[model samples]
Target chain A: MRVLLVEDEVRLADNLAAALRDGPGFAVDCAADGLSGDNLAGNRCYDLIILDLMLPRLDGLSLLRRLRARGDSTPVLILTAKEGKQAIIQLLNSGADDYLAKPFDLGELIARSKALIRRGKGQSHPVLSALGLEVNTLEQTVRRNGVLVDLSPTEYRILEYLIHHPRRVFSKRDLLEHLYDYNWEHHSNVIEAHVSNLRKKLDAAVPGAEPVIETLRGRGYRMAVGPEHTIEPG
Target chain B: MNQVKRSRSIAFHLIAAVLAVELLSSLLVGILSYGYERHIHFHAFDSILHGRVDSVIGAVQDAGDVDDNVMLDTADLHVPKDDIYEVFNSRGELLGRSPNWTGTSAPPAIPPHRHATFSEIKVNGREYRLLTQQGSRIVDPGDPGGGKLRHVTVIYGAPTERLWRAIHAAVQFYAAGSILLLAVTGPLIAWLLHRGLAPLRQLATLASRVSADSWHFSPPASARTTPELAPLTTAMENVLQRLERSFTQQRTFVSDAAHELKTAVAVVKSSLQLLGLRPRTQAEYQAGLERTLADTQRLEELVAKMLTLARVEDTGAAPGLPATVDLVQSMQQAAAELETVAKLHKIKVTMESPADEPVMVALTQEDCSLLLSNLLLNALQHSPPESTVELRTALQKERNTAEFSVRDHGEGIDPADLPRVFDRFYRSDPSRTRSTGGAGLGLAICKAVAERAGGSIALASQPGQGTTVTVQLPLTPNPDAASQLA
Candidate 1:
């Protein structure tokens, strides 16, 4: 599993990178501060991101938000020496997948990483399909018209949630709760915005496919079941 | 120099000395003046006595029988209102005298050696100066009608009462003039002393203002020429200049040390980040060493906090572009951010504000934000689970102060530890544990920030009770003080 490690403390970052490299089934790269970490996460590919909250040029929360803004679906785990629960909650809400307080157990950290990677691939199930759009869990890809479509890690997660449960009417709140680790403010509107962006990408990839998401006016949004509801490029 | 050691400053001592000498000499002059006036009164009274006796003798020579025409009633003798006289015949009869004199007659015998004499006598409990003169009557020895024998007679007198009154009035006038002179010249004496020591006072005030930040202590040019005090002034100026130079050097040393330490910390942090990116050969050991990395990260945080505290404590100003912040809004924002933490801890954290309007303070928004964040964190960390932490803000109107207080329901600190809570590296619980402790720099940093904003911090706690940390800041633009006399 590939991971991006962001920390400003040089010795600790170096030592952590060395340890992650030596750990079984893990490949880790490092960035000194939040700004560099954001750049690397945006331009490159990684399975997971290890972030530190305190950095000189840019802080971890802003970096996490920027990475998410760039449409990167990498799972992010926050590392911090701060014990305040507010800091932890803020990092989670801003796009972090998990957080480990400083002086965390190494075994627990590895286990958490594996769990995050598993979740990032969308809770691998027996069979998954949404509104006639089908995804093979084993192959980690989606298909329409019997044509295979390559899906990014984040696209796979979004498609996995819709495909796992079909015609059950999932609201945006439910999707956000199940997809992200932390809660956002009700006024954030980030969930709807991200979903719209995701729908556009999915429609482009699989032409003439039914729209997966349905807006349930004033209540939330859901995945539709009708054949005529094909998603346009947006 | 030693004589003036009791005085606080040389100017004070010089003024005191001059006033003392002036007082002593003025008193001596007053007494001397009284003495001279008394002397003149006595001499003038003697001359008046001689003139009265000469007129009496001229009248007696023209009278044929001394007892008949020269009977010498004081009214008949034509003496002025202030003079009196007495006549004695050959048989020594009492003749006339002034109205206030008490005696049967002039003394019968005159002193044999002198023509005129001055004497002192007592009458009615008052001492008087008496002048006497002896004269022989010229007579024909063959004529029975003339005095055949020359009688040796006596005369006595008293100080001229009129002369005494005149002299007393003159002495009183002089005494009053002396008092007026003293009154008029007192401020003049003070002004003179002040003028004489103007350079010294200036030099003193200048010396007092010399400090580490600015160390230029040169005595005023006017002081260089003062003949009496020039040496002392020059010596003081030299000493002050030396002190200023030393202070400047010390301040420079401190600033340099802080800058170097900051650079070194940055370098270390950056270097560690670079080293962390390299590949490692030992997989099993890296797994085991992950915890050590966590500890190293904690160490870096501790170092950064310690350096910040040291720098803030050394210089009492925060290195920030400070601006006025709304204190109430900052507290509200902090609470909103920390609500999730409060929920997790099962602690109810609420902000209690006095007014809906924002309470403005002379601190930047970031500083206010940081201060509130730290205070809330401390409150949440220390308070018991499920208990409430209360944050309050108030304006202490009487003292012209603005105050912020955070109260928690935790295990309070020991009384002895309260005083040192804000000291660097001071913690109530010193056990090295991540769950319940930090590097003990939080409160120290908060204190430095408050002091930098012209404020103060105080902590009060009782065992088994709650703890309240209060920060007090002085309000600006004292309108009440300005309008007080209006």
Candidate 2:
């Protein structure tokens, strides 16, 4: 995947490029400031574009706006030194895919980047195929044996995040970052509430396999894959 | 420019000038009186000498002289006037003396030209003037020893005491008149000048009372009673009216700014409520709702900070709230509240050992908390996760200042950017994105709170090396001093 990086600070930009180069199947190009970043974004097609909000020429918000206005559907991830929540929300409202604050963990940054690409590719929708279980992204519908299942939006998001990373365990915080779109004040109960809802909806759709979405006790949730999945009573 | 307001009135100056003229004229009158009295004494002595000499020339036939010697009774030759006369034949000899001339100094010889000569001589511890004349008079103009007879020189001596006595009386009378003149005219001259200056005085009182809050400098209709003060009054009224307009303009600006901010805050709050009212799908909420909440929060913080800035700007707190507070205890309490946040970020905040005795400071409690909270919170917020933030307080004996400092080992600020950190809403990193949650008003408020407490706040930093923020306050008063304590 080819990614475009927009940052005003040369050193930080260079560092991010070096980090992104290590990501699997990724090629990264950098724009030193907002003007060139806007110009390049206007004319180019890419898998993903990384943006910095405090840019020298044109700010990230306006650039994001112009990109969206031109009907470009490329995923844009905002990276900024400012940690104020207001600015983050502004960027997200203007159509940024995801955001990472400065001095963030490199592993988290990479995970977020991959997640954004997966979302752009529509790969995050859960495709529960066995035992008549099915999840649809376009219609946002879940059905087992042609019967639709009702789930809240938060529950659907949790189910989708698990199904996307099949067999990989997710902590509550990871689910928060992946399921919800921006950083939020963390409350562990929010994950529990959504997880409970997702379990009820999935159980109503396909009654036998309770192990499909299993909680790893102190760890978190994971999507059971292959043949080892089994029904476990709550 | 307000000289009329500061100086004494023109009336007072005019009165002082007039009194000076009267005093000078009176002094001249006293000196001239003495000169006239001295002239009277000299003329009286000259006539007495001529009368005595004529009597002697007329009595020459009664002497029946035979050998150039005439014998005659000289008692009848004396003149009755209060003058002393002596006869000499071209020689320095005294032939006759008056009763009052017993101890008087004789006169010098007369000049040969029949003219009297006046001389000043001291007699009986006082000064006197003497006159002498020489004439071969034809006895009494009626008879004579012919036209030219034996020439007899006469010297007249007179006491200057009587002359001084008359001069002294005149000086006394003149001095008395001068005193009366100054006493009666001083206040009268002052009153006349004051009457002329009354219009200006009214103008001054009117102008002095004009202020920014009220510019009602309506000079009385009668203020132009004197034409001299009319132009001045008009000029002052013009200036005052202009100032009144400018002040009204400033007040309007402040009120408008306050109203706009209030409206913005209300709109943001309503918008947030609207976004939260509906049950949102996760994607829908993430797409828009969160951003709205963040913006609302930013608006709220901005409004609150602006209000605080306005409050701190408007009123000087009367120093009535002074109370002894233990700064160490205050910092410890504030640090306790911040500890939970600190632990989440893995940062350890610890208070350094305070002085041997509690560092008691005199300040309002609210101001103290505000001052310390801003410094400590800023340090924790700016530092890297897991970094240690230290709070220290000490009293400098010589400087009489109690100091509190917070040090953070984070990504330090650049030197050029440190000074601007205290300006309201001025963020060095302009984005003010969600992660920091700062409106950049914290430090500015801290500075105001510290100053209101009669203290000061300053920042010291080296880029990449940490930053230290310090506050200094005056120590509490000595409780042992009763006067100071009261």
Candidate 3:
């Protein structure tokens, strides 16, 4: 998945962006001030935005308010220094999806970011399932009938986005838009390659398993509904 | 304590002055009224005595004979029981007297054509007011002088006991009236004073309610205040506003400190977690461990600076530490200690002191060293290579203070950033300070130390020219410079 981080502190922002990129398989773009962050957020299509409350040129709260006023509903997770209860209440009221105070655990931050992205895509549960295959968002791993299935980071992004809205057909352009930030020059064939790899992994992981991703004619991909399945607890 | 209390009680003093003035003036009025009433009573009694004496002369018409017989007629007159009368011829021979005249001699009779002579005399062991008069009958109407004149002297004496009794009763009434006037007005004055001071009492209540937990104090605008207390309310409000501002500033400082510390710890924690994520080659492991070690060192440095700042603030809060420090000696020691750093940076450290006597100040030796070393180290960090950093000490006897200054011939701070130089963790250029490994707390520590020593610190800088830091500490018990504590 694509992510955007807006923070003023140079070292903290760098380390956090690096961790997310190397560990969580995300295309992370960072902005040092609220002005640039606001500009980038308006122009880019990212799955999530991590915002710091204290920023130069404009504050995080004002930027958040403006983004929501302009009807941008990308999941927002705020990074705030301990500014007391009143500021926290104001931030939550101003369209922030979640918040993590500074000096927070890196594992917890990554977990919350994935959960927000899931919830933003109309998936209320932490784990999504299709035909006995499970996408555990909290553990950031997949399980097929009690067996581990490893996939490339890009393949995982496309699969997770598709699983959030099961059975919803997304064209090549639509998947490209959610899979890349504003700086990327995406090609539809590139997404085809990732999808092919993800299909091979899913089929090889469980023998005789039904294919979860189904391609429609003149359309893109969908998490196939071969049999009616209910969401199971992970 | 009583003397202090007496000085503070304005209400009591006001009432006391009013009572004294009221009582003294009332007493004078009472005395004046009594004197005037006595005059009126005596005049009326004297007039009555003269009138009675005049009628006595009329009663005498050369009784028995025209030559020697002188009688005051008592048959046709009803004499007062407390009064008596006597008559005498012009030759001073006793002629006729009233039956109540028991004294051997009457008051000397008056000559003809003379007004009544009133006198006080003791007669029969009783006090009497006597009036003497002279009158002639018709036997002297046809004569020119004394040839055919038959003149008689008449004296009338009236007891004054009854007149004094009435005057005494009126005097007592006047005294009682004065006391009654005070009784009616005393409490009314007290109530008025109390009502007038209600605003002051309300202000006291409002001040008492102010604490760290509660800052809401609403002064009563509708409460009445006199001109004297109006300023008091305004001054109190100003003080409360200042107090609130300080509290807010302190809160912001604590929150900022917490944020800095949290960020430091976060950097270290995230770096270690990421390094331990996967197995690596021996060289890569060494590199990762070294990187983690560096992060921990920075973290430790930040924590140490925070602790130093906290300790300085705490010391400033409680100033009971007794100490004696020589400003010049401390400056010399600090300059010597920075010799290695100066040599490494190719900067020359210079020390200057003109006085021979020790400049004793009220700060401990360790604190004085900390203050001087911080200033000198800051100067060294800012000074360019081959530049001179000067540390000097001087006695400012005229100002009753000892001065210590560290000046550097280096690029100075911008005018915009000069005002916030002493704020904790504030840096003019964050990237530059990071490269220099300066924690941005040197100037703040110096300022705190100076203030705790009953002194002040000031920085004067010209952009692109140089910078000078001057710390002036008041001397302890200077014999010739006693304005140190002022």
Per DockQ, the best of the predicted structures is: 3
Scored by TM-score, the top model is 3
RMSD of each: 25.2, 20.6, 6.2
Each model's fraction of native contacts: 0.00, 0.00, 0.45
For candidate 3, the per-residue lDDT at B192 reads 86
lDDT string for model 1 (B229-288, tens) is: 689877877877787776765554443334323333433443334344345457734653
lDDT of 2 by residue, B1-486 (tens): 699658975666677778888888878876776566556754665565456556654433323344233233466565555555555543444444555556335436555664766667665565655656664533233445443244555555555677677768877987898899899998888777777767766887888888886788888777765577778778888888788787885565454344334433433443443344346678865755565566567667767776876666454556554566777877987798788888888899978845556676775556577678778888887788878999998878698888999999977787778877776544566333223556557888888777766788899987777899999988877523322332
lDDT of 2 by residue, A1-234 (tens): 457888754434544565555333245677866778887776554568988765644778888999999899999998755545886788788999898765455556666876686677556532434334565643556676677889876676566556544667888877664443222466889899888777777777756655457788999988755566542211
Assess candidate 3 and give its TM-score to the true structure.
0.76
Q: For each candidate in the order shown, give its overall lDDT on alpha carbons.
A: 0.66, 0.66, 0.80
Worst 10 residues of 3 chain B by lDDT: B477-486
Task: Considering the two chains of model 2, state its CAPRI-style docking category.
Answer: incorrect
Q: What is the DockQ of each candidate?
A: 0.01, 0.01, 0.45
Estimated TM-score for each candidate: 0.36, 0.42, 0.76
Superposed Cα deviation of residue B59, candidate 3 (Å): 1.7
Residue B86, model 1, lDDT: 57
Model 1 captures what fraction of native contacts? 0.00
